[model samples]
Target chain A: MDWIAADWGTTHLRLWEIDADGGVSKRLDSDQGMGVLDPSDYEPTLLGLLRNRLPEGRATRILACGMVGARQGWIEAPYSAVPIAPLAATRAVKAPTRDPRLDVHVLPGLSQAEPADVMRGEEMRIAGVFASEPGFDGVICLPGLHTIWVQVSAGEVVSFRTCMTGELLGMLSERSVLRLSVGSTGWDANAFAEGLDRGLSRPEALSSSLFTLRAESLLRDLGPEASRARLTGLLIGTELASVRPYWLGQDVRVVGEPDMAEAYSRALESQGVAPKILDSEEMTLAGFRAAHEALAAHAH
Target chain B: MDWIAADWGTTHLRLWEIDADGGVSKRLDSDQGMGVLDPSDYEPTLLGLLRNRLPEGRATRILACGMVGARQGWIEAPYSAVPIAPLAATRAVKAPTRDPRLDVHVLPGLSQAEPADVMRGEEMRIAGVFASEPGFDGVICLPGLHTIWVQVSAGEVVSFRTCMTGELLGMLSERSVLRLSVGSTGWDANAFAEGLDRGLSRPEALSSSLFTLRAESLLRDLGPEASRARLTGLLIGTELASVRPYWLGQDVRVVGEPDMAEAYSRALESQGVAPKILDSEEMTLAGFRAAHEALAAHAH
Candidate 1:
C-alpha cells in the first residue's frame, strides 16, 4: 500500500489502505473517533490505528475527511463555502504529527451562509457521487443523522439544506414522552402512509400529532410497530413539504445506506417521484479517490 | 387545616392544606410524583408527605388532580371526554388506601378523540380559571413543558390542542446539536422577534433554521444568549402559526407559571395579540376548590 483513505467522524473512524494500482488492499475500523480524543491525542490515535498498516518506506500519506477536519478535530480544515466543488485539494489541511513516518491531510467541510448550514463528511460522499456521474444536475438526498438535500449543477454543489429529522426521531423515541408508545422495531405501512399524508398536508400540526401517538396508544391501543412507523413517516413527510422545490418534478438521486435510501425512496415515491438509489459506501470511496487523485495530479 | 388539595402529575407532587375558611394554611411538595411510584407505593408516599400536616379528624379528605389518576397511577380515575366542564366531581375516582386517616379522591384527566389529545393537571388549572371567570368564551393558553391551548365557551372546554414546544426546546437546548450554541439564560429581543417572524412565515423551514443557529454561532460568532432566545422564538412562533385558529380574533387568557406565561405573553404580543396572564397556581387552587364545593353540593 502506498497511501490510505480515512473517514474520521464524531463516533466512528474507518480507514482504507489504497495500493498504487488504485485498489483498496486492506481496511480497518475503530472507535477512536474525533469526538472521543483530545487535540493532542489525535496523532497518537491515528498512529496506533495505522501501526501495522504502514508501508516499509518513506512517510505514508493519509487523506482524511469528516469531523477530523473540524475546529475541534485534529486540525481545523476550515469549511469551504458552498457554490464550489465539494472537494478542493487546496482546501485540505495538514495534521501535526510527531511521528516521522506518517503524513496526513484532513479535507475541509462545506458551509452555506444564507440558510446557515454546515456539513463535514457528507461533502466527500457527495463529491464521490459527482465523481461517478459527472455533470449530474438536480437533487441528491443523503439521509442519516442529519439528512442533507443538495442541489447540484455542472458538477458543483450550488445550494443545500439539512434536516434534523433522524436526530429528532431518535431523541423523541429514546428520551421524550413518546418513548413509551413507540418501540425499536416495527413496520406498519398503513400507519406510515397515514402519517405521511397528515404531515405533508398539515405540517403545522406536527407537534400536536406527535402526542397523538401516545394518546392513541393509551386510549385506542395503537400498536408499537404502527406508532414507530408513523413517527418516521410524519417526520419525512414534514421534510418533504419543506423541500418540495428540490424533489417535485425533478430528477432525484438518493445516496445512502440501503435502509436510509429505501426510506427516502419510499417518501419520494409517495410524493409521485421516483428517485434512483445509489450505494453510499461506493460513492464515499469514490469521493476519497477523487480527492486523493486531485492531490496527486497537483503534485505531478 | 380542614382538608388538602393536591396536584399530582408525572414528575411532581404539590399539596396545599386548606383551612375551614378556604385559605391555604400550608404548602408541601415532593418528587414522589406518579412516575416514580407503583400502585402500592402511592399511599405510603402520600402519607410520608402528609405526615405532620394531617388534621385530627375521622378522616381527612384529599382532593387531587392530575396523573395520580393515570392507568399507571395509584388507581385509574378514567379520562372524561372533552366538550365538557374542566373538572367533573362526579368523575373523580376514590383511591383504595390502607391508611384509614387518608380519604383520597383523584380527579380524572380530560381527553379529546378526534385530534387525540389529553390533559391532566392543566384541566384543574383551567377549571380554576373558569371558577373565577365563569363565562370565559375565548382561548385559554396554558404554557408549560407541554403547552395547551383550550377553546372555551360557557365555561366548558370545546376543543384543545397540546404543543410540545417547551419540551422540544428543552431537548434541543440540552441534548441536541444546538446545545453548544444556546445558553440557559439570555434574552435577545431582536433575535427572538426575528426568529418569530421566520418561524411564522416559513414553519416548513424550522428544521433548517435550527441548524443555522449552530452554524451562525460557529461561522458568525452568534452569542449564546441570542441563540437561546432565537430558539425560543422559533418554537413559540411555530406553535402560534399552528394554533392561529385559537387566538386569531379572540380574547386570550394565559394561565401558567410566571416565567413560562411571560414568555408566551411576549410571543403573543409580537403577533399583536395581547393575552391576559393569570397565575397558574391560583387557578389550580381555585379549580380544586370548585370541585370540592361541587362534591359538597352533590352530598347536600
Candidate 2:
C-alpha cells in the first residue's frame, strides 16, 4: 500500500508519493497553487496531479492537506476547538473523478479560536511529527507566511496561535517605505537579533518602532543590515508579547528553515527559554505518513 | 515691491500674492506637484503655473520653499547638516530658467549626517517657528509622514532628527500583516495612550514589539483598537528612544495637528514635561516670508 501526500498551499502545490512506511519515492510540484484555484476546481487539480503520479488502475489512498479543505476548498471541514488538536481521522470528501483507480481523501485543517485562525497543511505535519516522537506534549512552532504555535497534548492540536510574522517582514522590507532603508540583500543577522530582542522587550511600542528603521538609517547612517534587523525585531517583539504566556510552562519546539529559526530562537532565548529545533521537511513527511496510515486503518 | 511666496511640494504648487506689508491678497494653487516633476522640468512648471499669478510685465522677487529644491526639483539645493536647522539664511539654489521676469530663489531643505535622510519643504517652517519666538531654544517637533525633531537655537534649526512614525503606521495598518488584525475605523484613544506609554517605557524593545499586534489578536483575543494602539506605541516608543536625548534640558514646541500633539503631549507629560503647541500653517507661512526677505536682502 503506497501513500500519496499533498501540501496544497496558497502559493504553491507540493505533492509527494511515498512507500507505506512514509519514505519519499517521487515528488512533483505545480504552480496551480491554492491561491490561484477556485474552491470548485480543487478536486480536478488534486485528482489530476495525484492520478498523474499514480498510474491508472492503481488504487492508492491519497491524503490532502492545507487550505484546500477551507470553506472555499474541495470540501468544507468545520473547525476543531482549542486544546482539541486536529484529529488524524478526517472525513473523506467526495472528490471529482479524473482517474479510474484512485481513492482520494482531503484532510481537513483545524480552525480553533476567534478572530478565528485556521490551519490545514501544517496541522498534518504537526500531527505526524508528534506521532513520530514520544512524550510530545506542548507547543510545536511551524514558521512560514502564517507561523503557527500548536499546543499538543496526547498527539492532538488542542489549541494554536497564528502569527503572520513572515508576511509582515516581507511587506515592510519589500513594499513599504522601509523598503528603501533595508537596501537590496539578505538581512544582517546582528541587527535582526538586536531588533528581535528590542521588540520582545517592548511590546507596546510595536507600531512606532517600525518608523525608527528609516529614521535610524537617516540620522545614524546605519547600514541596511541593521535596518533589516530592526524591522525583524519590531515584528517579533510584538509576537513575543502575545505568546509569552504559552512559552512560560510549556516546552517550545521550533520547526522551520534555519534563517527564520535563528530569530525565533534568539527571541525565546532572551526570555530564558530555549527552543528545540526539528527538521522542517522530515516532520512534514512524517505528519503526512501518519495521516495516510490513519485513513488506511479506518477503511478496514 | 510686492513679494511672492510659494509652497512648492512634491505634488502641488501653491502661490501667494503678498503686499509689501506681508499681507496676502491672492492665493493660487495648481496640480504641479514636486513628486512628479523632474528637476530639469521644475523651472518650466513653476514658470508655467506662475504665468498669470504674478503682476503682468513686472519683475517680482519670487521666493520658494519645499521640494522644489530637491535633487529632482527646479534647482538642486544641497542639505545642511543636523544640529543646524533649516534657516532663512539657508542656501537657496538658482532655478534654471532664461526668463529674468521670474527672479526665483528656491530654499534648500536640510539633511545632516547622511545623504539618505533629507527634508526639503518644512525646513523653513522649523526656522520660522523658532525665529518668531526668539530665545526659544529647545526641541521643536513637527509630526507627519516623517516626523521632524529640531533643536532650535537663536531662531535656527541647530540640529534635527527624522522619525518615520506616521509613514510606518500607515504602511503597517494598510500593508503589513497587522492589517489582518487592526480594524481601521474608530480607533480606541485609551488603547492608543496605553500603547504609547508601554512603547515609551520599553524604548529599546521598540524594534520587536510590533508582532504583538497580530499575536494578541490571535492568542489573547486582542481587538483591532488595541492592536492599533500597540502598533502606534511600537513606532512612538522607538521615536521616544531616539528623541529622548534631545528632549531633555529644553523647552519643547510642537508644530502639527492637535490630536497628534495631544498624543505627544501626553507622552511628554508622563515624563514630567509639557510642550508648547504652535500652528503648523502659521509657522510654514512665516518661514516662507522670512526666506523671501533673506533672498531679497542678499540681492540688495
Candidate 3:
C-alpha cells in the first residue's frame, strides 16, 4: 500500500487504502467517530482498526480530515481561512503517535471570518469537485446535518453560509411536539410540494406553520406520512428561501446522499433552478486523492 | 366547600376549593397531571390527592379544564368549535366515576376550523380575561410551550394562531447542536434586542441565522448567556412578525409567566405596540370561577 486516506467525521470514520498506482486497494469504515473518542483514543483506535494491514518495515503515511481535527478531537488542525483553496495539505498538522508503523497527518478545515462559519471534512469534497471540474464556478450545496452553500471563484471558495436545516428537521420530527404528528418512515410527495410552496411564500410564518401540522393531525386526521413529508418540505423550503442569493441565476451542484440530494434537487427544480447532483462518497474519495497528490508533490 | 375548580393540564394538576361566597378557601396541587396517568389512574390519582379534603358522605362537584379533558386523558370532553365563547361549561362532559361521592365535569377545549388550530388550557385563561372585562374586544397573547395569539370580539374567540416558538426554543437550546452554544441560565439584554431585530426584519434568514450563533460561539467566543438570550429573541421575534395582524392596531394583553411575558412585551414594544401584561395564574383561576358560576346558573 502507498498510503491511507481517512475522513473522520463527528459520527463516522471511513478509510481507503491506496496502492502504488494511486488506486484504492481496500476500504473500511467504523462508528468510532470523533464524537465518541477522547483525545488519547484516536491513535489506538486507528491502530486497532488497521491491525495486520500496515506494512511491517516502514511507517505508513495516513492522511485524515474532518472533526478528527476539531479542538476536542484527536488534535486541533486549526482552520485555514477562506478565499483560499480547499485542499490545505501543505498546512496539515501531524498528530503525535507512539506506534512505529503509524504516521498520521490531519488536514485543516475552512473558516470564513464575516458571518462566521466553519467546516471540517467538507473542504475535501469541495477540493474533489474542483479536481473534477477545474473551471466550475458558482454555488455548491453540501446537504447534511449542517447544510452548507459555497460560492466558488478561480478554484477557491470565495464565500459561504451554513444552515441548520437538517438538524432542525431531525429534532422537530423526532424530539419536538411535531413528533406526535410526523412518523419516522413515510413519504407524501403532494404534501411535501404544498409545504415547500407554503415555506417559500411565507418563511416568516415557519414556527406557526409547524404547529399547524400537529393541529391538523388532531383535528383532521392528517396521516403520519404526509406530516413527516410536509415537515421536511417546510424546513428545506425555508432553507432554500434564505439561500436564494446563492443559487439564483447561478450554476448549482448538490453533493450529498442520494435521498437528500434528490430532495434538494426537487426543491430547486420547483423554483426553476436546475441543480446538478453529484455523488457524495465519490466526491469525498476524490477529495482525499487530491489531498494525497498535493502531499506527494510537497514531499517531492 | 361549595365546589372544586381544577386546572388539570399535561404536566400539572392544580385545584381550588370554592366556598359558598364563590371565593377560594383552600388550594392544592400535584404533579400527577394527565400526561402521567391512564384512564383508570385518573380517578385514583384525583382521589389520592384530594384525600381528607372531600366532604364525607356527600358528592362534591369537580369542574376541571385543560388536557385532562383531552381524548387520551381521563375522558374525552371533545372540542367546542370556535366563534363561540371560550367557556363551554354548558357543553362540559361528565366523567364516569365508581365512587358515588365524586362528580367530575371535564370542560371542552376550543378549536378553529379554517386554519386548523386547537387549544386545551388557553381557552380557560381567555375565558378568565373575558370574565374580568365583560366587554373586552382585542387580542390576547398566551405564551408557554405552545404560545398562542387569539383575536377576540364581542366576548367570543374570533380567530387564533398557535406558534411553536417556546417548544422550538427549548428543543434548540437543549437538544439541537445549538445546545453547545447556549446555556441554561444567564441574561444578555443587548444581544437579545439585536437578535430580535434580526429575526423581525429578516425572518426568511432564520435557519441560517440560527447556525450563525454556533459559528459566533466558536469564532468570536460568544458567551452562553448571550447565545441563549439571542436564541430566545430570534424565535419570539419571528413569531411576532408572523402574527402581526393579530396584535397591530389592537389592544394587546399578554397573559403568561413573568419572565416570558416580559420578553414578549419588550419585543412588541420595539414595534410600537403597547401590550398590557396580565398575571397568568389569576386569569386561569378566574376562568375556572367563571366556568363554575355558569354551571351553577344552569343548575338553578
Candidate 4:
C-alpha cells in the first residue's frame, strides 16, 4: 500500500488502502468511531486496525478527516475560515504517534463566522467533487446527521448552512412521543408526499404537525410505516424550504447515501428543482486522493 | 370525605379528598403515574395510596381524569367528540375495581375529528376554566410536555390544536448534538428574545437555526444558560406564530406552572397579546369538583 485514507466520524470509522498507482486496494470499516474514543485512544485504536498493513521499515502516511479531528477526538485541528479551498492538505495537523510505522495527518474542517456554521467530514466530499471537476461552481448538499448546504465559487467554499434534520428525525422517532407511532422500519410513498407538501407549505406548523402523527395513530390507526415516511418527508421538506435560496436557480448536486440522496431529490423535485445525485463514498475517496497528490507536491 | 378527586397523568398521580361541602379536605400525591402502571396494578396502587383515607364500609365515589383514562391506562374511558361541552361528566366510564369501597369513574378526554387531535389531561384545565366562568369564550393555552391550544365558545370546546414544543425542546436539549450547547440550568432573557424574533419571522429556518446554536457554542463560547433559553424562546415563538389565528384577536388564558406560563405570556406579549396565567393545579382540582357535581346531579 502506498498510503491510507480514513473517514472517522461520530459512530463509525472507514479506511481505504491506496495502491502505488493511486487506486483503492482494500477497504475496512469498524464501529470504533471518534465518539467512543478519548484523545489518547485514537493512536492505539488506529494502530490496532492498521498494524498488519503498515510498511515494515518506513512510516506510512495516513490522511484522516471527520470528528477524529474534533476537540474531543484524537487532536483538535482548528477549523479553517470560509471562502478558502476545501482541500487544504498543506495545513493538515500532524498527530503524535509512538509507533515508528504510523504517520497520521488530520485535516481541518471549515467554518463560517457570521452565521456560525461548521463542517468536518462533509468538506472532503466537496473537495472530491472539486478535484474531479476543477472549475465546478454551484451548490452542494450533503444530507446526513447534520445536513450541510454549501456554495462553491472560484474553487472556494463561499458560504454554507447546516440543518439538524436527520438528527431531529432520529430523536423524534426513537425518543419522543412519536416513538409509539413512528417505527424504525418501513416506507409509504403517498404518505411521504402528503407530509412533504404540508411541510413545504406550512413550515410554521412543524411542531403541531408532528403531534398529529401520534393523534392519527391513536384515533385512525395510522400504521408505523406511513408515520415514519411522513416524518422523513416532513423534515426533508422543511429543510428544503429553509434552503430554497441555495438551490433555487443554482445547479445543485446531492452527495450522500443513495437512499438519502433519493429522498432529497424527491423533495427538491417537488419544488420544480432537479438535483443530480452523487455517491458520497466515491467523493470521499476522491477527496483523499486529491489531498495525497497535494501532500506529495508540497514534499518537493 | 364526600368524594375523591384524582389527576393521574403520565408521570405523577395527585389526589384531593373532597368534603361534603365541596371543599378539598386533604391532598396526597405520588410518582405512580399511568405510564408506569399496568391494568391490574392500577387498583392495587390506588388502594395502597388511599387505603387509610377510604370510608369504613361505604362505597366512596372517585372522579379520576388525565392519562388514567388513556387506552394504555387502567381502563380506556375513550375520547368524547368535540363541539361538545368540555366537562361531559355524564359520559364518564366506570372502571371495575375489586375493592367494593372503591367506585372509580374515569372522565373522558376531548377529541377533534377534522384535525385529528386528542387531549387527556388538558381538558380538565379547560373544564376548570369554564366551571368558574360558565360564559367563558376564548382560547386557552396549556404549555407543558404537549402544549395544547383550545378554543371554547358557549361552554363547548369549539376546536383545538396540540404542539409538541416542550417535548421537542427536551429531546433536542438532552439527546441531540445541541445537548453540548444547551444545559438544564439557568436562563438568559436577552438571548431568548433574539431567538424568539428569529423563530417568529422565519420559522422555516427552524432546523438550521438549531444547528447555529451548536456552532455558536463551539466558535463564540455561547453559554449553556443562553443556549437553553434561546431554544425555549425559538420553540415557543414558532408555536405562537403557528397558532396566531387562535389568539390573534381573542382573550387568551395560559394554564400551567408559573415559570412555563410566564414564558408563554412573554412570548404572547411580544406579539401584542396579553394572556392571563392560571395555576394548573388549581384548575385541575376545580375540574374534578365540576365533574363531581355533574355525577351527583345525574345520580339524583
- When just chain B is superposed on the true chain B, each candidate scores a TM-score of 0.98, 0.87, 0.97, 0.97
What is every candidate's C-alpha DockQ against the true complex, given to 2 decimals? Answer: 0.70, 0.20, 0.84, 0.83
Can you tell me the DockQ of model 3? 0.84
lDDT of 2 by residue, B111-216 (tens): 6542235577777668667557867777888887678777777655666667767766787789765787887865676777777776666654332356556555
In angstroms, how far off is B85's CA in candidate 1?
0.4
Which ranking of candidates, highest DockQ first? 3, 4, 1, 2
lDDT of 3 by residue, A158-268 (tens): 999999999999999998878888999969999999899989999999999999999999999999999988998999998888889998888999999887889889999
lDDT of 2 at A176: 70
lDDT of 4 by residue, A1-300 (tens): 999999999999999999999898999999999879988888888888876878899999999999999998898899999989998899899998999998899999999998999989899999988977788989999999989999999999999999999999989999898998998988899999989998989888899999999999999999999999999998888888888889998888899988789998888887888888888999999999999999889989
Candidate 3 clashing pairs, residues 3+ apart or interchain: none
Which of candidates 3 and 4 reaches a greater lDDT? 3
**Each candidate's clash count:** 0, 55, 0, 0
Using DockQ as the measure, the top candidate is: 3
- For candidate 1, write residues B1-300 as lDDT tens digits: 878999898899999999999999999999898888999998888889888667565688899888899888888888889899998898888899776788889889899998888888899888888888888789999999899999999878999999888889999999998998999996898998888888888886777778889889999999999999999988888888888998888899999888779988898987788899999989999999999999878779
How do the candidates rank by TM-score, highest first? 1, 4, 3, 2
